[model samples]
Target: MSDISPTGLGLRHSLSLTAGTPVLTLTGIRPAEGIRPGDRLVARSGAVAVLAAETSTLPQAEMVAIGASTLAHGQPDETLLVPADQPLLLRGARAELLYGQSAVVLPARRLLDGQLTRLLRREDVELVTLTFAAPAAIYAGELHPVTRPEPLALTV
Candidate 1:
């Protein structure tokens, strides 16, 4: 359809991201009268709030796209595409579907000492992960600290 176009630039890669999988996504504050996709909203709650017509300061690390089949109850009447790096959270019906097709590349590194060094030193590493089943819970959303750092800080 005319509504779907590939002109907008952000992160567009070919990969299969299933619905309901935890991927970073946004959630817009609902209005008193209620709202739908494409309906502009003034965020009044969440990690941060933004006045209508203003930019937001909320970090986009915790947002994730959910599967379509998962949103059977309280389905939003409308669905709209959310911008990848914007603060305006879009909540309507099936907006998470737009994000479900995303392709995420996990970070990996090689060490000179490799497995032998890690075994000898007995060093440990951890990877954090989360999953939400309810559509409402997914819409409610959560925020987490990014694994990557800007300036590189050491922790002891």
Candidate 2:
């Protein structure tokens, strides 16, 4: 199935399960559902990919590349605190800017800069961290919320 966005960017489709998958379940950081199945993923003409957790269920991803080193390894489903103006290569995953912070949670792919050493050095975003359960630990045929944050308190 082919889906098109209002921006006219053709939604690229890939088999949910491809042959010889390099990474079966991307752990260490939460990945946006866009990187998952049943959705469209897009990146800039020549931008790197950084796996990120999904903050919302939108069909658009926005990112900014501030510098050569702006990607950091993150735990699956964890929020990464980053500085604004930092070069970011975001995949097609819509995100929301949290209050009191300039960091954003958008869909991202893997880092693709040849300067792995340097990039790894400079790209050190603070990761909130997450704990992933093994496939056997997860119960199938059950429904659960994909994203659920801690409840906030309201001060009346």
Candidate 3:
């Protein structure tokens, strides 16, 4: 299959495991799920991707760049968390890959200047990850989701 997106953007057609309940990745200093109970809240996004846990389920040809999870998704020891009240910036991101499977977080301003996929390819990398410890948006030109958030109290 060709890696080129027919529209030069991206094709959105995956079913969210949440049964089409659209979600926003909470961006910034967030922990794995379960840190805060019932805090399954996610940041809203005009940008989202239909994702499957495995690459084989969703064709790689469809993705310009991929982040192969820094944390084990289903690992027994891994815990997940979400923030109820978080400050969100609905923008895109450009992930600077670090030494190993880790990711280097950069300000989104540095990312907004160019298309994320094309930028990464230009930078000579394919594995771009969005840090959940900051405001990271992934839309058409960007990749999938990851998030973080500054501490905020839950709102009623």
- The global C-alpha lDDT for each of the candidates, from Candidate 1 onward, is 0.23, 0.24, 0.26
Tell me the deviation in Å of residue 67 in model 1. Answer: 10
Candidate 3 segments whose C-alpha is farther than 4 A from its true place? 1-102, 114-142, 154-156
Q: Candidates' TM-scores?
A: 0.17, 0.17, 0.19
Off by over 4 Å in 1: 1-70, 85-156
**On residues 38-110, what C-alpha lDDT tens digit does candidate 1 reach at each position?**
3332212222211111122333222222222223352222221122221223333423443443322121111
lDDT-wise, the better of 1 and 2 is 2
Write down the TM-score for model 3. 0.19
Output the worst ten-in-a-row residue range by lDDT, candidate 3: 79-88
Q: Write the per-residue lDDT of candidate 2 for residues 1-156, one digit (tens) a residue.
A: 334446644333211111111222323222322243322222222211322322222132222122322332322222222222222323222112222333333212222233321122223222221112110111101101111122222348
lDDT of 3: 0.26
lDDT of 3 by residue, 1-156 (tens): 212244453322221111111233344223222123232234344423223221112112111221222222322121111111111122222122222323443322222223321122122112212223224343211122334332332348
Alpha carbon lDDT of residue 36, candidate 2? 38
Reference-based TM-score, model 1? 0.17
- Who wins the TM-score comparison? 3
Query: Residue 139, candidate 1: how far off, in angstroms?
Result: 7.5
In each prediction, how many residue pairs overlap at the backbone (N, C-alpha, C within less than 3 A)? Answer: 9, 17, 16
Error of 2 at 125 (Å): 18
Best by lDDT: 3
